[model samples]
Target: MNVLSHADSALSLLPPVVAILLAIFTRRVLLSLGVGILLGALLLTQFSLGDTSLFLVDTVKGLVWDDGALNSWNLQILGFLVMLGMITALITVSGASRAFAEWAKNRIRNKRDAKLMTVFLGCVVFIDDYFNSLVVGSISKPITDRYYISRAKLAYLLDSTAAPICVISPVSSWGAYIIALIGGILTAHGFTESGHLSVFVQMIPMNFYAIFAMLLLLCVAIWGLDVGPMRQHELKAQKGELFDESKGLPPGANADLPEADTGKIIGLFLPILALIAATLYFMISSGADVLAADGNAFSVLGAFENTEVSQSLFYGSIVGFIVTLGLAFAQKLSMELIIKGITAGARSMLPAIYILLFAWSIAGVIGQLETGKYMASLVTGAIPFALLPAVLFILAGITAFSTGTSWGTFGIMLPIAADMAMGSDSTMMLPMLSAVLAGAVFGDHCSPISDTTILSSTGASCHHIDHVITQLPYALIVALISIVGYVVLGYTASVMAGFMACCAVFAVSVVGLKYYAR
Candidate 1:
């Protein structure tokens, strides 16, 4: 049956709103999501008890087994997660992480250097946010812990850099997804003069939230600008209390495996390098297949534009896992121990997997109800042209924050923003589009229900709620600067001037908070 046929207007928004409110108040993510799903199903069935029951059944079926059997994109994602878990487990069990941490301990020297190293590593893995967060968190946690850096801070660094970096990096999976979305909308509207890639390139500078977030991360790393709950966490960390033991920690908290007598850094470096290389290879090859199917000539950018990123990630993880397994065997690790490590690692990720399923289901339900279209209708004709970018930014942020999915927000907002821009001065289109992207990232960064947030905590072995609480202030600071930047750009139509103003504001805010905000 067609799910998108139903459009419930403002009522369509209740599911996500209920989900977010319940999560914040109750701090029970799974229960909140379950209630939200039931509410959505009831709404979808128009409160018919029999249909609602069937809808819930179908929802579980769809999430667990694509349509009927366990297959499709959901399965691919699950496979990737399992492989990643195994790889992380193997690295830790083999003492590769400890080996690398020991090697870096001599050189890193201080807490600031350790934090900066985490940021550097996060930025380097721009291929995918999931990969970035998990890998960086696992690799850096040992070193950060050694330097008495809080797990909350490490989580913040992991999260802030993951989505923000991917969104801005031209060659990333996020960039490819965005270009395709823009291209589809523009193609349908018969507006293809500059091409989607060219437009996306132009919009890069206008991605103020991402630019500002990376800048703030740098400042936090270099100058030790900690404020809000983060500052308290840092203070506690300085007293050798990295995390409150009274509060429950997520799985993989003690990820630093016992050191092997002959452990080498090669165990850690090889799998990571393999994962990156394999993912790139798979992305290009997968894209090439799509291009050939469409009878188009081969080109790196063109192929990437058509690549199946999820599938590529799945394949890459598999390769990485195999390489790690080989290394474990080569090191003469017992088969039983290797299997145990893999199981342990995969078990740690089970919570994240369940959360993802619920998040995806809610997103699907929201799409079915046309919540995005309904929200878009509210703002499409109400705003003045000059303030459109800022309005869209806020709307996108709210949508993403409520739904906990940036891609869903993009799917809902980008077309509407593009159509609105078509009627106004053409110069504003790029900025408005940029605003949607920036706002989505901002919201995702802040939302506790966001998958990246969950993964970041899992990676750092921090309490999930603690990570959410500590990271919110930092995300808000950048968001505030981005909103002001968009407002100024709306009037001046000069990206450079607006960017400089935002940077200055950020710098001043940092200095003020550093000296006076205690």
Candidate 2:
């Protein structure tokens, strides 16, 4: 296989653009993504049929097996997804989901509290967005289901909170990755007076989209400020239509299964707790091992930077699955039923796995085309200093949206943002970097191909397209506010001012919408 690099041309935009537009209009995500992958391979192989076919085969094959070895990261993620599905299925079969829902029914008296519970859980699980996205959904879905909250809305809460919280938390995978990247960028540009950690801490307030999006989600949940497609979903939910089964359920949902009256809530709590504990333990231990190998002291933050997130999640899920099986057997579930549950669970995850596989394929194709690089190149020279942050925000958003990866957007745009700040106004560096983070998240929330977006929907048991459509209007609102905030910060070079401006605008918007609903 040849090492494919970026094409460095406008043609790089064609695949993702066509794929995104097709997904939006046709609502056939797999087909749309497949078309995009095909188009990219054609372009990459210069339309040679044999070469393009080989490239496509190699791309898919590399997902699990590459260079005579297992691709542990990708394989582990798939393993975790299946393990989570199995856990959820066993819980359902044991009637633990119903027991938990009944337990919550007594204390959670209203939809508002139910929605807030989801938000709270989302906030508490901040280690990794992949973990946060799925675990929180599985835990909260039953409570929200009892309250008639739409899966679409549940997914919104999950999606909005997952990345936003991860991006800001210093102990998280997102934080560690960003901190390390910022360290290199700082060194490259001769900004040595401040360390990357301090700079990252300072930029927290400057992350307008992430902060504002959290606030907006809270407002939406508390005030019933549903808008656009979400409003329709909510209305239907109130009428006992929580999910549109016509769109098909994401893998791992056993909502329609019968509940055993003898089951206990502990069945639900114990497995999930075990999963969380095991995951955190692996993350720390693995990271510590790396630090030891490099002769560095083991610190929590250092561990996070070196942690294998997918591998940790995979191992954690296996622990959780074992716990779940123990609980099921203790409940006196027959071997036949246990076997059925396991098979059903694995089968349920197949859809999510397929979508993830194709999504990864297209993302790889996008990388070969240098779509992000081409997009980043558009913002290179001669921008007004006052608009630099704003421009970076929009550019990062577009890149992430088109490429279907926020982290990739950060890799492509952050250094350029650093370079631009260095050349123009070095004092605006943190603000500019913050803007890139904000925009990448903004774009990620809106992109149909984004893995977190897919995971959110799967976790919530909502249709993928439904989650994408319902979340878009809300994401756009935050993006617009963030852009204005960045423009203000760029001109004034004041993180405080920009943050305040974003808060004020968001408050007014939420209040106005509440008033309008009345």
Candidate 3:
């Protein structure tokens, strides 16, 4: 069971991706992560040094100590830390976060409305998961408490919509990431004759997971057909469930969220605006000069050629932090209070900071082992030629589910799709590549291990595991339909047919589930 035999599977496409996935859903994230890391390390050690145990120890020690792949990921983790600090400082200084909560409490006439409103708010603020979680959870907690909505239900709604909307919306953080990745895939696949197209014309339509996630959210909102962990939580909420966990005091926790702090929210707004403007500028420039890799907007965040998504957030967040201070000074709020707020926000992000490091460390190890290429190769080798597209969807799902990382899977699969397009008929390339993107996103969206899941839980003040459990079934059902859509499209090579089929499934599933479950 602990064997790392697939060490030299020469798999870059399909098979090993599933291995990563299997390790992920084995339930305990830390345990699953350790298992995957150990497995890969052992196999690598065996392949290179002929000592499995030595490899395991070295990988761990290297990760904890050495200046290698792990170091690069740490660099990214630092960005996450900075971004969080900025978010906290901005929220507290402006008082807008607290104002939003107060405003929500004042608006609520009853508990049910409060709970429903929480869900409504989660949808309205659809730009970033961090903002959504911090603002929505902070504002909704007291409101949900008043209405008897349990912590779990609040988290469920928060987690459900947080990344779901971003993935679909053209203007949000998800859009920037996906578009950039799509540009690369297009370039590799020769979607454009010369270089990677910065603007993805067709890929957006094929992003099935994000699309179906939105549909799933719509269904949950309209039908309220809660089931499994979610339904159990809903009942507990109805019964006035309560738990006193004393989850640490993050800075944002100090203020009621989404409140109209003319200063704080405004502070928050300036940086966000800066980020959006920056992203648009970068994307446009990249699109204009498709052949230039350096032209990609993501690559030029704070310093030149720094496309790290977190850096963009960090730069904008720095602006936000400054705005918070400026606004506080203008309001005559003591420097002491501003410092206190920043400290609190950083504290709240401590867990995220740690998780980011660990996730990166693991990814670092996987990268060293060429895990993506290995898995992609394995899957491609084993896949029946006729079922390559179907397998792509499945592998993408498995990869996302295992790593709680749709982005990581996207990085892996997009290249594979490009490579695949070269070997196959040009017509077959786009549809299959689109399926890969969609499936990877679908898997990550619902995974408990997903960062998105964590954000959702924090946003709704829901228990971390509870959010994962509640949202899983719905994600699976949609995944099933996505698989079906890919299959239909695989045979016909028709995006429209696949799109229509998915819509049809959503319609029937919603109606049938509502009728039958009722």
Candidate 4:
């Protein structure tokens, strides 16, 4: 492969920096991403207008079609996404989601119960962050609303669980992507003994941001500890003012189809169960050949290690879509209604799909420019290895924050982080990797331009900026704790001890913030 390269210079930072600034100022993610892509294309073409235009055309075309940059992997992901959209839409159109909501409403008598249910639902939909954000937000919003929970707080619950859960879950899209990145880096460097899945599992304990975020969410929900702007929002919501008049609301998704007369909760539960079962089955079956090649019959972890995650997800989602359609038909839905639901679901995913395409393209441009190398070069050996995890955490956090995409950050940073950890004491490698993953998630949680964040706000029917402002404090607190945890882990190199110490620190910090910081 003949890779394009550019000289390391200040110009290398233009695309991401421009994107970040535009996104923050305009609060228009799609525009920001498009500008970034255009800038990158210009730079890659050496400022030739003709070449940049042609590159843009080719890139846009390639994003959807198979012949260009949208290879098999990209297509598989797209398939999974579309299928998931169809499933979600079908469930909604079938009135299954409404039934589930009504059932929960009867059971959930108070705010605490409502919040707990929201968190629980968010955790349950761990297949993908996008799915988690949309489904949890849509299903839990009405229940939370009846209890006077602010849309901002609901958005927080949705956003907090999305990436944080996905990053740690062994079978999620995020996990699969991380595994692939790790596996590629390992193979590129000729290190074969350390399997990506094994390292990913090991790093789970060290992913302090994700762990702390979930814990903090539960604590906040259980105790009703609202601080910063969130406190104001919650108080106002309690006074029958769910939204601030000053802050304009973002448009929410409307399922215009009429609810079925005989809506049953089973309609929702069965499809979700089917999705989970299908995913596991496909994951295991797809890896069967690889496991046999290694003279192994089956082990749960081993099957996951050998699985073609994208392919498996694609197959699983297809099965899920089929099951959802079957259930809709069983409910005697008209053909027009079913088709409308499928199209509506896929339509809702279009914005996210556009963002992913642009994010990926800009990331490709960054690779060609060796942006990772340039960034890595700034970190010198004079910084003690003991502090490397902390340093890398900050760096990765900034990178992901600016890009508003954790997957892009992982693609750019994991390889460099892996190379940096090579030939060092093995204890340090997992921590460094964990730091990268944690930082990326932290950044994604905070970035207003983040697709997950945007989806969360939409899901909760909150103003976008309100969601960002209210959630920033909580995310920052957790991020600070994660940085401290990484620093401790760096010196201790003991996951157990480090986790205990970090938990102690979190306890003190959150308690103080709860009672005093407000």
lDDT of 2 at 276: 98
Residue 107, candidate 1: Cα error in Å is: 0.8
**Candidate 1 residues 277-340, lDDT tens each?**
9989999999999999999999887877888877988999999999999999999988877878
What would the per-residue lDDT of candidate 3 be over residues 1-518, giving only the tens digit for each residue?
A: 13343435553222234334553455334545555555555555554545766666665566446654454434543554555555554555556545544655667777557656766877777656655665567556656766666666666667666766666555555655666676666655556663322244455676566677766776675567777777777776676554324534322233332333354335544544554455345434434344355453333211212234444444545554565566667766666666666666666666555554445545555565555555566575655454667788888776676555777887888777767756765676766777777777667766655666666665554555556667778888888778777777777778788788888888888887688557
Superior by lDDT: candidate 2 or candidate 4: 2
- Best candidate per lDDT, number? 2
lDDT of each: 0.83, 0.90, 0.60, 0.77
Rank order (by lDDT, best first): 2, 1, 4, 3
lDDT of 4 by residue, 1-518 (tens): 12245537657678878876786677676787788878878788888888778877766666566553457666786677677677777887788877877788778988999999999999988867766776577668667877899999999999999999999987776786788777787788776887778778878999999999999999889988788899999999999877775644343533355667666888877776776688778877777778998898776655665777668767877888888888888899989888888887787666556655666677666656665556656665688888888888888887676566788788877876777788566557778888999988888887755667776876676776678889988899898888888888888887776688779888997788778635
Off by over 4 Å in 4: 1-7, 66-70, 125-131, 134-142, 145-152, 171-202, 227-252, 289-298, 334-340, 403-427, 448-470, 492-497, 516-518
Give per-residue lDDT, candidate 2, residue 149.
96
Model 2's alpha-carbon lDDT is 0.90
TM-scores, all candidates, are: 0.94, 0.98, 0.74, 0.83
| Model 2 segments more than 4 A misplaced | 1-6
Please give the lDDT score at residue 17 for candidate 2.
94
Q: Which tens-of-lDDT digit does each residue in 219-291 have in candidate 2?
A: 8999898888899999999899888877766655775565567889999999999999999999999999999
